[model samples]
Target: MPLLFLNEKSWGTACDPARAERAMADFVDAVRAAAAADGPGTALVSEVDVKALEIAEGYPVNKWIGVSPRHRVLWQRLRGLQGRSPVRSVFPTENAADHLEYRHDGEVVLGLGAAHFMDGIAVSLPVARQWQADSVALERGELVEDDDGTLDMRHDTVVVRHLSAEPHLDGHLEWIRKTRSEGVTTGPRIWDSRADLYPHLTFLPRVEGQLGSLNPHWVLSVRRALERLEEAVAAWDPATMAEPEWRTKVSPEGETRKRVCRFTDLDGETRTFDLHARFTPGAGRIHFRLVPEEHTIRLAHIGGKIRPDL
Candidate 1:
């Protein structure tokens, strides 16, 4: 027998578990109306109340419903439903937050927390049939962008030659690897100068004075030097540090030459690092150091000449 449901407007037939589903559906509709009205004093759905109802109804929470993160209640509910689902690929958001967009094939199955669900309402069905359609298109080799705006194509698989035990450290390294692979010449520079003092060790200038005065070839040199530094760090081994062959040290010895830097690691331990130089024709030189304990490399400085003070 179909269950009868009574709301403020009308009565309707809600069969068995569909009663809960229908109630949720109505809640979504109310949220949508409130958002669209854009009027003062509009009441939005309470996440706590929605969660309680979902728990009471025993509904699957993490289903991939084509909604954006702006629909907080609906988005979180879908996340809960699809939390355990297998994902084929993961993509980072533009803001570089820890939360990532998880995709199955070319369709987004999860990670919509950074998206705008209400924006897709005009084209998307109330129940997320559009996402199913996208999945089919993906299977057909069609390209699409996921809800969080990440390209849905299968990225070239990167087999990490060296893996870090620390998840956060590994994530930071992966970000650098991906940035290098994509040939991203401009973006936020890693500010670890306080960790070690080689001077301002960055490829791109963060200040107004650095905008145009930088030499083009020098920029390329710094970039390539950084890439090589990343590769070397990826393959570094602490156990073999005693071997001279394993340690590739460059020249220019004196008070003006390379120096050791000491900094505290994420674990709150002080570690010492030795600087090495990589020269680029017409672009001067770049100084960097490998910290084996942290499983990462740090760019120390870039300059026309080595400063004795440093």
Candidate 2:
């Protein structure tokens, strides 16, 4: 299931206490409705965010919750979630390093940071510009304005904004509904079909072309392998990533290891892409290169497995 983190930065004072309470009620309702349509997902929260929820706009939000018996019960359930933790508790262990460092303003943004680290969605109120935008940008470890007055990142973290607005709520529901129907659409980015695979996979341009011509029969197998690879890449340290044996035959090229295992990248530099996985016996193969220092995978080829004897 998807993991949604509460955007702590979205909490702030408002001029109209009633309006603020209404907005909070709407946001909570939207979350519950989405969960009902899809299966319930883990909602990550921090002590800071929960306390902020208790008091915002010069009024206690819990009082608003008490006004509605339904809301009071729903709020209690959300408060009992196991994801509630102290600030910065979401950080991974010291050994498993990654390139995507979480950053915000000078102050800590615990929820967004945790969402990014965990490859989950950051659920925010329509308050700050960073949370308001469909996408957000970061520069030199800080959230910065974008060229088009928006925010973005390639292979970016997903941020669902403005739960109270119908348009934005519709967008969030689209994701949830799709996730329920199609399994891969759960994370920050939606991978509803083969067309939606590129952004999440991040394959090299030439390798992408190879995917187009692949046999139709092996397509599902390939998708499964890539999905597993995506999960592994997110969870494991790159240096030791190959330790696990994958069901889809993730391993180095065997007989042709010396010959076709090396390929030139877009930069015209010869690089070894020995890591490979088979779609099936003698059917199709996916060979890729891993950049450990950057924690990235550059898919070099996706075609028939090379065989020296053949």
Candidate 3:
């Protein structure tokens, strides 16, 4: 699950108490929904103690939760193991990453539990620019991307304003899927690799035969390249969507590109699997044909570099 950090900086002072209470209510509801969607205790509040914070001009967030009738019930379910626990303070035990900040395009964003956005956590927008809290004002419906390119330029980070949004959920699920793909080396025999590991892939029989002949050292690379294809196909319809060059690239063009890129499909007809991902520049490759009609990628070859001059 993607980490949802408590945007403590979001709790600005000097606002109307009633409106702040309502906004905090909404934030609580959003957190509840996020926790419900991702699992219990998925939302983190703050390490500095929420008691000192106010949602509105007069109402402290902790006080509001205790006094508000609706929040009283919901907080009970999400508090976890203890009545004193208002919000999760520590990162989940399942998360192994040792870091909390990630740097992108020179601007540093805090509270990302891991290195990459795909596997790390999300911090609310307007996050302390340059480590100075209160530097950026938190506003509802504000696109931090416009301010710092946090959402627009990066794949990670979610805003508390809209916890149920598609992009946030998709990113979290993508992390889970990626984690599930991590242990490719311990998978079944080469013959079963296709069915066991590459469920999203439609392997040509010849490609399966080639799998057995591939260097064991190179198998991990093949798994990674194919995983990229699987992620692309699962995320969008290739027929209507543009190719994700970031994940898989057009097989390089050269004289050997024509002969090496063509392969026999399961139908016994020769077809071009022009889209390819390289595991190694000149040593390993995954040649694949995208079947837009079926919305899947068929692996034509899974070993050795195929180039223009070959």
lDDT of 3 by residue, 205-281 (tens): 77656776776545544665676777777776665686544465445435545576787788889988866676531
TM-scores for every candidate against the unseen true structure: 0.28, 0.47, 0.40
lDDT of 1 at 238: 59
- How do the residues 1-310 of candidate 1 rate in per-residue lDDT, one tens digit apiece? 0000111111112224444354345444433432333323222212122222332123433331323354456655333321111111111222232223323345442222111111111111122222212111112121333323354433331111111012212333343344334433332232232123113222222221332344433443345455455545556565776312222324333433324333344346554333545433322444444545555554434544443454
Off by over 4 Å in 2: 47-57, 63-74, 77-83, 86-100, 104-107, 127-166, 173-310
True-structure RMSD for candidate 3: 11.0
Model 2 is weakest, by summed lDDT over 10 consecutive residues, at: 139-148
Residue-wise C-alpha lDDT for candidate 2, range 1-310, written one tens digit per residue: 4456676666764546665665566566655554454565555555464644643565666676767787687677656544656534543332221323454555555566655444445666554445544444432232322222343332333332334233444666665665456554222222235445543245656665565566543444466567676666556575666543343446665554647677777678987788876543133567787666656566777767555552
Lowest-lDDT window of 10 residues in candidate 1? 1-10
| Candidate topping TM-score | 2
Ranking by lDDT: 2, 3, 1
lDDT of each: 0.31, 0.54, 0.49
Residue 28 miss distance in model 1 (angstroms): 55
